[model samples]
Target: MDIKKITLFGRKDVKVYSDRPKNIQSILSNHLENLKDKEAIVTEEKTLTYLELDYYSSSIAAYLQKKCDVKKGDRIATIIGNRYHFPLLVFACAKLGAIMVPMNVKLSAEEMEYIINHSKIKVLVSEEKFISKVEDIRRRSTHVIPEEKNVFVIDGKNTFNKLIEPDYPLDSVTVDELDPAYILYTSGTTGRPKGAVITHINVIHSLINYQKIFQTHEDLKTLIAVPMFHVTGLVAQLLHLIYVGGTVYSMERYQNKKYIEYILKYKINFLFNVPTIFIMMSTEEEFKNSHFDFVKKVAFGGSPIYQQTFQMLKESFPNAELHNAYGATETTSPATLMPIKYPKSKVNSVGKPVPVADIKVVKENGEECRVNEIGELFIKGPMVIKEYWNNPEANEKNFTDGYWHSGDIGFMDEDGFVYVRDRKKDMINRGGEKIFSIEVEDVLKSHELITEAAVIGVPDEIYGERVKAFVVGRKLSESSIQKIKEHCQRHLAKYKIPEFFEVVDQLPRNASGKILKNKLKEIGRK
Candidate 1:
């Protein structure tokens, strides 16, 4: 449990602060008391100090307790986005010991209803844009609302601000570190979204992991372009900034040009997002002309980074350190991180295990794999969630002994750097030879005419499955396809080379920018 045992490359023996706040409320209170006047949150609309954030959240908690009868362990579902009100509601629920369920704003009415009813959410809050979807769900959802007042909108007449009691005193609610704080739903590509129950201790430990990995200091300013519903935005960026008493500038949504504008406007020092955002930014003309001198560190995750994009980022931000972080929603945010001073030799690796977590690659027989051998990755630590919400089958299947069986296929080098290959189900088998789709996609991305690439296995009568690549780049021509095939043949083995090539304007992605292979399979069928 001693986090200081994990050493970095440059700093051999790094000491991480072990003492942490018991719950989210305590973390917020500490910042409020010590950094009251410091700028806590910034948006295009307004700015809030720590003192104001505490007061607003406390007042909202008091109102929810008195009016809606919200109590400890009650579920409050929010369908809001990256606005200041989103965090206000999150902190309010944390203060009252209620579990916050941040639903994805892009989900359909049926999808929203499934999560709402399954979580048994007592209160529902949504933005105006999504109010119609909430109404649709309320008409058919199994979870009944006692009254219309239980539902609050962010911009409509029944807004969250109207419920705020400015002078009302919030009753103190006792919260344990082990208590459930929030339940974040997975992308649910395979089936219905399973909610991952994250505890207060898990979040605090994750904050410590980020702090040690990023070497956080005071006055650190970050621009949050990712959605708040994601662990990367909530735990890694927003909450971590608050834990360090730093400033955060949140965007309602991500636009490549606007993201650059905010970076300069806020003088952002830290940047964290998925690889797609960075790739889009690097391709923009404004990004090439803008100055990124204020950016000190750039961290990305949720998917593998192509070598071409990595080099683009390195050249774009010469002063900043580019880090490729690796984790899932089950592990809070990050389990392994490539350090700022990482070597070029291990550039493809996701670095070593973080200070608070441990990782191992294991075979189907449950035996640990040797160096450079591909196997399923398993993560263990205080930061790892113990189970899914109300999903006993998933808990039984995914959790073994104290480790969560991450469904990712990867390997570790002799130097302890982890290299993620592909998802367990994403691996393609042609005849007896196994092929990782990511390897082919990475090679395709390196091609001069290719902007993005996705490789999937299509059903083949002889080989069971054959490699097919979907690319977004120059117009497809006989010569262009031949050129790409030639490039793949040079880099990959004969069997690993894609047998079919399809040119598309774009690849389908989930909210986190991960390529949806399921959708690609549907395309293959057509």
Candidate 2:
């Protein structure tokens, strides 16, 4: 079967180029030269043409070069959200070979300070909403810069508009393919967040993989509701859209009902979000009435999607194809993607390994596991990051044998489909029986009243660790807990059943929609 033809909407015989250009500017130049008048990006009330995007990016690049003395490989941090200026800011950094460090909006001042200081960012481009956080950190953090003047707010009193005038452009600086393009910080749920140093070649390979696996079209209008700080938002959403001359519509944040409204309003061809957002939207009564007539495809990534939630999304948006993806910040976004066509079997699988990325299930000792055997998932290819920024320890532990250890437990079927089990660190051990949190969570979610659920191991003097679940809802009762356990018993081993259940109003989650298992565990312990 032709993967390109199956995934992409256009020509099947188009040559797939594995060799990436030296710099990201080359990609921008090519797209600008080819699709000058095309709409490259669209925000709430702004539309940016390809030519305009090129000029603005070049202008920002010039400003960085002259004002901040930023050179190739210099780290510039951005504490912003999804908007028309987001992609332009990223391209500006890329054009000058400056690494763009994206700050997570969901993180507190301390988390932001850690990333900014650890990455050694010289200039910070932030939005007004996060200015206080930056200021707070600047005042107290000894590691970060003490002066607030070092930070430049986007569309604020001290904005990039002053640095770059209208129609101002500069000579494009050339960059090597291996030069670092961005420093994307992954949530340090296990430890301090590590900044993955993604290169131009890494992004180029990721774009190619998205085009091949999703069959994106040049005229496609992608809805980029995901935050640009994420690998999915950067490589898969914005960069890919620009590379293919497609249009991207940005959102400040993901709101289930509002997201559906945006889709209907924009008639978006491509929709990118996480499973949680989709799950909420799929169940929303308002979404059932909305017309998704123009939405050709919906792509979800960042975490595992429950099977029932997938089915619910499919039922709600029957006109559009629902696609699942798997990857991390170190993988330059999407390493694997489910095809647009609905899978006839194992609907929860994250599809197959994308064209440029190779994935394998390996044992703890680094040996490849057989099909259907659960093990650590390792991804290898051009899309994988070369190293972590100033993180020697992380580089040693995560990158080995030319594969990035995903720290995710999963398996591959005979047909090459990947099934994510859970995070290696999130696994709960009660006595000798191993319980995957996702298994318990999925079972709990199957209930009609439960909105969200997370299973974590809490301290137990007798069992080493005891299985405990935190649910999100007030409708839950003792019968509901028993039903959840009974459901888990049917699908999982006896050891996997939760010994304790606590029904809360909600489960603590990070900004990217990932359940904060450590936070849940802390609560359980308390």
Candidate 3:
């Protein structure tokens, strides 16, 4: 388990140190001591330096300890967006040894209720826009206190402003690195979201991964367009930036034009978002001629990127290093990253396993698959989460022998690069023929007329399941469909060709830009 050095960016070998801070609080305490006046966070409403952030978080921690009686291991949930309040609550929880549970703001009342009750959350904070949703959940869920005093809003009369006591002394608490710092719920494509228990050590390890792989340093300007609820934004962008004393500018929500404007206005040097955001921004008229000289690094994940979009980004940010990263909520943020100076010959790979992590492709019999053989991906490292919150069944099913079963189908090449094929559930079996949806989707996206594509399996009367594609395109004529079919025939097997094609103006996506294949499947059924 001793990691001495890590090779990153193709040639940079960075030393991996074992004597790091035990917890996030210690890390922040160091920053406060040395870089007190450095700007830490910038939002549309206000800016907070390291000193101010420490003061506000400690004040909030005092309020929670006195007013809410929050203690070590208590859960405080928030439905807020990417604002100063979210990070404030997070660090406050760390200081008080409370576990912060950040729920997705886009969830429906029922979904929110399920998570709130499932986690046994005590205090719930939300924004004014989502006040009604929280109210509805409070009525439905017994875990949430159905009183005005317990629920706080961001922009309304019921706010956290009154709880701030800048001069209040913070109670001393011993927090273990192994203690759970946050519980981030997975997207839960198939069922209810399961909270991934991310510990303080996991967060620190992921921060190290970002610092080593991306080569980030202090004073770096980053624009976080992704939601803070997701690991990509929380661990990779926000927390890492804070650890390095960098300035973070957050967007409440993503608008193609507004995102471009922020890049130009803030002179942001580091950009991290989903592939769909980049695709949309590259095609945006405003971004067509926008200068990207300020951008030094661009990192993308959550889903696959089309080859055409990758080429366009290369042309757009000719001076920037483009990285396609792969990880999950369970791994904190990134387990494998495509190197900054990656080989074009291995463009499809998600790069090698990070310094602190190990990856293996295994067959169903628990045996490791040979190189180039497609199988389930298993990841192991300190960065891998120890358990799922209150979900023993999921922990038992997903974790075994110090490795996390990723539930993703992929393979590693002889040179150690990983290429993901598809999620195990998304694979199609048509008349005993296995078809990977990602393969078909990749080929479909290569079509000149198609803007985006998602492939799914529809129930077939005789074949059990058949391939179907949902696409966003300019033309949907019979001739265009025929041309698409012909193109598939040239690139794919006869049985792998999509049996049905649905052309829509846009694909249904979640807040993270992951195509909701379940919604597509429901549409196919109807």
Candidate 4:
């Protein structure tokens, strides 16, 4: 509970939680002493206690160390989606002081191969379903681990069986809090993904930030529906619970029905997910009929929660506290969090900086912006990753001073709350007027008939670019389009309103529910 100013990772005067665990292993060890017998993980296949998870990971870690020659600071990659085995491998990596790179399951073989070669992954664990992609990568290139020896499968028979034989003792390894424990690749929506090297110091500060904001305890049980590849799933849901000695429930995939069933079946008390998941769930009859009064906390990010979805969640779980979180992989999952009380007046804001986070908004010309003036956000904190893995070009371009330039464009309110406008790349320029896509989309969503909205700029000869909007709602008719234009006219400026409107069933999204703007531009081209 002590805040201290100390030198960390060559940086002086950085804020950190004094007396924090020296490494990830130490934090797990402290929890194991009192919570060894408590339920640690619950999955569709089986439930594991803290003692069992520890035991299993020890045997697995010993196998990797003894057989694969995995030592401190080696990179271990997992392609198992969101199963129990994912967390099993996480603990296994933690025990060995190894860095984990949880591969994105939705990527093509070529994309996956790029990561394998880039990270130089020494060991790989994959699910039976995704083995073919691994085989393709193996056949196409010699840059990855061999299938006959170093590669292990989760639900298939292979050398993976030796990992659970119960004879290998997990030995201790000395690891510093500043040592890299994770390398999460960026979303790569723009180009090739770059890996963010996160240290144990980064992870510890992030865990403490969540703890201070949420006041989590050993009794807390949260369900994870997101993939482990993301910081939201790995650091926010899994590692945070491990640090608090709390229970975690895993969903191998996100399904609305299964989501309703799991929360009711497990008596889950906490929920963390993107806004799209909550929006999709609200439409189901099972969700509408359910009583989730037992849930105490709900946190959502990736996008702001709209008014309708926010109201639905409030009415469903009257006792729950809904908090908005704003973060990225480079920031160890949270840069800003909604205040503990979640004041309704600031519902649209992402809220204030986490205790350790220091943010500065800057203009395109690189000067600091005045309060309430929109610009890009640069974040500096002990929780922020020191640098990207193996990419000095990106490192030089993305960081300034000690802060990581979070390409997201937004502004800080007079009250210190942060409001994320949109990605800098998504902003539309018409003649000399600039329009943030989110501002236009937010106005469109305000219409009672519009369920969702996305905006993009299409090439135009007159203004260089023009606004286009994609809306989802009741089957579109000519009258509906006219009505939408009228609604937009009342709220948005003439320059900001879309020149084109396309009614679609749904917006394209990645596995994490982030809208794919690149795909939308392609559609706009046609």
Best by lDDT: 4
Tens-place lDDT digits, model 1, residues 35-109 = 999988897777889998888888989988888899999999999888988878878999999999999899999
Candidate 2 Cα misplacement greater than 4 A, ranges: 1-16, 19-22, 141-143, 146-150, 166-169, 341-343, 477-479, 486-492
Task: Report the poorest 10 consecutive residues by lDDT, candidate 1.
Answer: 6-15
TM-score of 3: 0.95
Tens digits of per-residue lDDT, candidate 2, 1-526, equal 2222111112123222545555667767787667999888888867889898888887888877876778877888887788766788887888888888888877899888888888888888888888888878867975585345456777658575755564444555778777888888887877798888888877887787787778887878877766778887778888888877788888887777787777777787787887877766766777877766667777887777776777777776677778888888888888778986644886878888887556889998878899999999988776778888888888888866677899899899988899898899888778878778887888878877787888889888988998888887658876677777777788777777778888787667777777778888788889
Number of clashes in every candidate structure? Answer: 0, 3, 0, 0
Which residue segments of model 3 deviate by more than 4 Å? 1-17, 146-148, 475-479
Q: How many clashes does the backbone of model 2 have?
A: 3
For candidate 4, what is the total of clashing residue pairs? 0
Alpha-carbon TM-score of each model against the true structure: 0.95, 0.91, 0.95, 0.97
**What is the model-wide C-alpha lDDT for candidate 3?**
0.85
At residue 222, what lDDT does model 1 achieve? 90
TM-score of candidate 1 to 2 decimals: 0.95
| Local accuracy of candidate 3 as per-residue lDDT tens digits, 282-365 | 778889978787788888888987788788888888788988899999999898988777789888778888887878999989
Tens-digit per-residue lDDT, 78-141, candidate 4: 8877777878888888889999988899888899898888998888888778889988987889
What are the lDDT figures for the candidates, one per model?
0.85, 0.78, 0.85, 0.87
lDDT of 4 at 304: 61
lDDT of 2 at 54: 83
Question: What 10-residue stretch in candidate 2 is worst by lDDT?
Answer: 2-11
